[model samples]
Target chain A: MIMDDYKFLFKVVLVGNAGVGKTCLVRRFTQGLFPPGQGATIGVDFMIKTVDVGSEKVKLQIWDTAGQERFRSITQSYYRSAHALILVYDISCQPTFDCLPDWLREIEEYASSKVLRVLVGNKIDREDREIPTVVGEEFAERHNMYFLETSAKESDNVERLFMQIAEDLMKQARSRDLPRYDSNTTTIDGKTSTISDFSCCSK
Target chain B: MHFEIMDYELPTNFDVVVVGTGIIESIISAAASRIGKTVLHVDSNNFYGGLSSSFNLESFLKLNIEKRKSICMEHSSLNDTETFFPINNSDFTLDEVTHQWNITNKNKNYSDEENSAQEDIIAKEICAKKWLKDDLLKESRKFNIDLTPKVQYARGDFIELLISSNIARYSEYRSITRVLTWFNNTLEVVPCSRSDIFANNKISIIEKRILMKFFTSLDDNEDLIIKDYASKTYKCFLTDKKLSKNLIHYILYAISNSTDSTLCLEGIGNTKKFLKSLGRFGKTPFLYSMFGSGDLPQEFCRLSAVFGSVFALDQPIHGLILEENSFKSILIGKQKIKAKNFVLGLNLTPDFFLNKVKKKFISRGVFITNKSIMDSDNEPLTLLLYPAENDKNPCTVLELPWLSSCCPKDTYLVHISCNQINNPEDDLKHCVKNLFTLNEDFKAFKPLIFYSSYFSIPTNSDENVNLHDFNNLFICPGPDSELDFVTAVSKAKELFLKMYPDDEFLPRAPDPEEIKWDGDEEPSDIAQ
Candidate 1:
């Protein structure tokens, strides 16, 4: 809970086809504050959540986007700077489940290299889940994505998702600090961005 | 092998038969079984995985590791100083192999030189041009798509509209899908106005107006520019303004490239339909898969199995058997099973199904792997690699963190789809060979072959061809031209009605007689 430790900012973008709950999930996570009822997210909304992962105190900047087909040109820009992405699909809906690859592809394009993405099947609480859990895990596993089934309404695994992202980022930072690779890192775009400056621990 | 689960002799005849052993077929059979009816599931191939399955685990894992390493490079570069982003050691470290597990010293020099050449070629051929006015005009006529040429400091253009406009109010995933739809011609993009939206003070006045003017005129009509600049293909358009090459490439990569732009407008359309069909969402509008894409489907199967849904393997339905007013049972390996109801989750022809549907619709290309290629203690999850063609190739590639279920260490799988638009046999061969030459990481791993095929739905109907008129039959052909998505899903629904009773509702599926299979001559009334 220390303010200094909370300085570490990790931006996470939620992306998928239209009506995949990209917005609802974000609002559920950010505004719901871990377990509550909320409506759809408008256009683009950013929320800050402070979470303690073991000893590391991480501040998560969550960007909830609109999944409509007409808005790709407008919302695509936000994808570039994200440190991680949560690709969500409705389990009750097969097409949404089918479209997960495309959503993951966007994360690959716009997000930073260090982006840690988790494939999430939202709405697992429903009785007639159209998409089976096995298929979903296979999709994520095939693409090397960390996979999980979660219900934003149930607030199931909501906390675990963020904690995992924070852990991933911390591990990435440490790995970059390893001996063989140079201390100074330059981005693929040639800009000299530094993650070490924003480095903060959970404690 | 466990013999405790004895095989009950399956029925010899079925009312309807479905082909393909992929996820879609599994769902169809499971759904049929859940409704208290007997169903037969079959695959033409000896094994499963028609675009969705991981037959060869080694390549899958290798691809993932390479993807992770690429992401690691991106992470390190994003954090590094100018010029150096530590390339080695992260997430899963290289014990003896590079991030891609390229252990052979012979390939290292070739890989390095090849990568550099590819980069240069990509930059020169793909990145040499700025967005011209005419370049923004052309798009897929069928899909109603369009794009704006990227010009440097061209403020107020599509990019500005994207950043400034508050589109989230319209829908949960409006902006991203909107942009992608526009590019893919799946949805019509009503260019949101960008004039007042770009009035940021941080940007200088000139830059601001450039951005502003560009944004405001995006919706205006323009000419198409298909030109070759520095040997790279340039599809530019005019919007009453001009921009730089760098800006244009960024826009294209962000919207059209492979990695980030995998799903286009068509995908959005199907997804939108699915969400709407679910009715309303309350406090719990959104749901996520517990274990990944594979887990959710598996859960559905688990639930369906509990409900007595049977999934038959090694059974591929080649053709349907009709008997008078009702459809007879399907033939699977000289065995026939009879059912009170039947639902087909297959294409009209197996080969056509494989070429058009399996290769084009269901499959995706990716780099996957297991066990970190990087030498490190606590492995990083994702990696971004620069493919030789990253600059010029419209498709973007990345290595994601390894998934244990798909590939346990030292094992991996990657899916390669032949261009359905090409000649079938040639396309498949080229697809396999090109996969190896396309990326350096794939070169190290030997590809153990696997096969799966799917077909597209039919269009243009003929008389006397009712696939669902029979008492004991129904078919759910994935996505097709003749029938709508609602009709396809409800084909199963109507079949379910045979078992459950509510006031008999209208048939939701397209009339079977209306379905038109390609290459088949129209059945005349006399024939009927």
Candidate 2:
């Protein structure tokens, strides 16, 4: 899809279990500044970073949800109507990595079905890997999601992850025949790929 | 010279010293100065009035007016007669324009309840009545100082009115008479309605368009401004189409074009409330402050000067050498001195004298600018959530235009405040990006404007005092130096009056204090 078709800014949410280094990943990618010491994200922190993935000044309103369970309800609310979703898991923390299925089901139900989903296995920085990168990628492939391994602390493959998502979303946004799906309940399936039905912009 | 008060006699040596010649240290050095004070006053910076000093500021203001007039000439059609331009291109900062658009429609949707609050302008007459009965008046009278009605007189002194009104009440929510409209068959406050003007001619065509924009300003869409949407409420009387256009401009011009809804609402509500209080009172002056509010402190200083109140400059007190009974202090480049009484008129931030006493004081940087970064003839008052980049020393900036009648044309003042907080550059940048517009005007005219940058000193927060004195302190450090500057000069004047009841007080500008430490002790935290 041509990137010039979209105009208005959009806010996308990234949700996953704790120890995922979601904050570090975002900081490395958006600011290009390494975190001195990464800490667990406390509450909701959002960053509006302009990316050149589609050769346009597209501002991505990236909202990072806290991983703590008590914050689940708060994070759940942001899932509604999000243009895209990045459900991440820590490869080192098997418990967090295991929660991917629940996370996917939740996004499928709460977020738009057509929402562009990307599965990220974070914390690939350590040498002694807990969850194999192949397993994570296989899991993503099975679920029809584009998967990639990232290390926010070490600054590895972080840019490519967001750029790929942004590129994919721009393609969908550029399609004219695509029917505008409700914000929640949309998925990344190719069947609804017809670009004709999509209207110009709501504003 | 040094004065050391030791065992009723003076000591010849000192540990720390503070310098600079301004009223900010008046109370701080008064008692110390009284007893063979070794206090040093220096004016190398060539400024004596501290922050309130009108000496250099006056000519500085005139230069601003000249600059603005030139811009007016550049933008005018060449047919105008008045050399004094109302407002022009150079008069605004780039940040103000971008800020204006963003604030007016940050969200893109409109809310009726919030808009109605904007509509009730509270006419001048109505405001006087409210002021007469305000509880703050009693405190003012008890203090026995006459607070000349500042409302309706000079547009600048209105800040005092708002400050006082907030003290008396009206800061909390209150219901007011408003018109409602049907949207999707549900009753909503009519977005464009005003109570000040006659109902029939309340709005004009341009005002209607502006009102529509104001209504839609709250849309969450990325294209709109959120701060301006929240900053103003435009109420319209829809019976006539002609008035809508005029009313919209009127509201747009009147409000600082702030997109922050909370800030917009608070500003408008406080303004109307101030006027309402004035209307309640019978006294209303069209042009208040025969001299200016800054004149008030200057006059007090002048009176003190008539007495034996010797003033100095450039000599900043590095630190106060306080030990047991007497506080001996050293002045910059001078020997230590002792005083009988010591009152500090300097900003009371932790670093003020904390390190002198403790020996390890850290300096926090705060930035300030007066350029019109936000849209408004009088720039919208703005606060930065944070700065843009952090590798740069993280500092916070507080921007407010000094529009007092005493101030010159389109003179936007910028202030950056920081304390102990590091890597706040991103926060500061965010604040500038979101709240202010970095327009071409700012870029072209920035060099022409002198940038007076200073670090903020913390002072005691006068929260318990009546609203008039709420934030009042001899010197309170905030994110910048002006806060301390304002506090120190004002507080010095008060303390001076107490000591010398019949002296003429001459106002002065703020001065920086040099903090002293022995080997490497941290500065004490006096700013709490």
TM-score (all chains, Cα) for each model: 0.34, 0.27
RMSD to native, candidate 1: 23.2
DockQ of 1: 0.03
lDDT scores of the candidates, listed in order:
0.37, 0.37
For residue B170, model 2's alpha carbon misses the true position, in angstroms, by: 27
RMSD of each: 23.2, 28.4
**lDDT by residue (tens digit), candidate 1, B94-135:** 122112222222322323554676665554442232211122
True contacts kept of 1: 0.00
Off by over 4 Å in 1: A1-203, B1-5, B11-18, B30-38, B44-48, B56-248, B256-300, B315-319, B345-398, B403-528
